[model samples]
Target: MNPTTLKLCLMAVLSLVGIGLYGLMICRNLIKMVIVLQILVKAAALGLILAGQMSSQINLGQSLGITVIVADTIVAVVGMALAVQVQRRLGTLDVDALSSLRG
Candidate 1:
């Protein structure tokens, strides 16, 4: 692909990353924030993969992406479980509303 096209794609990825981060920061709901955070993480992984591949380091890029994907899956599953438990116990998933910790 041409450098111009690559630059455009990078810009688009960066824009998505920015929007995801902004949503994560501004969202009051736990689920929305978590989803946005995941998006941000994925965008970062994409950026890393793109950079690595552009450098002719395909193996390195694949390895890095696999690691990130694995970590992301684990984190997302655990976080979702925790969020569900919290919502059930607290009756809401709002961050500010959560204060009492169940022993």
Candidate 2:
């Protein structure tokens, strides 16, 4: 790949990571937080692929990206399930509300 293309891809990865972090920090809803986490994981997968390409190991990068995708999907599913339960029992999806719960 050309240096220019590599730089662009790197910029994209950085942008995604920045946006994901910003969203995670600012969002109070559990579902939105889950979405932000997905964005962060995608950025990580992109970074891994970019590194593999730079190192001339594209296949390894692709395999790692696929693995990340699979793991993230499972995480998202579980997160959504928890969100649903929280909404059902607590009547809200706010993180602050969850903090009031006692064991």
Q: Which regions of candidate 1 fall more than 4 Å away from where they truly are? A: 99-103
Quick one: best TM-score, which candidate? 2
Tens-place lDDT per residue, model 1, 1-102, is 689978987997899899998897789888878788789888878887888878989789889988998898788888888899989988999987975665
lDDT values, one for every candidate? 0.85, 0.96
lDDT of 2 by residue, 3-94 (tens): 99999999999999999999998999999999999999999999999999999999999999999999999999999999999999999999
The collision pairs in model 1 are: none
Q: Return the TM-score for candidate 2, rounded to 2 decimals.
A: 0.91
- Top-scoring candidate (lDDT): 2
Worst 10 residues of 2 by lDDT: 94-103
C-alpha RMSD by candidate, in order: 3.1, 2.0
TM-score of each candidate structure, all chains considered together: 0.86, 0.91
Q: Could you tally the backbone clashes for each prediction? A: 0, 0
User: Where does candidate 1 have its weakest 10-residue lDDT segment?
Assistant: 94-103
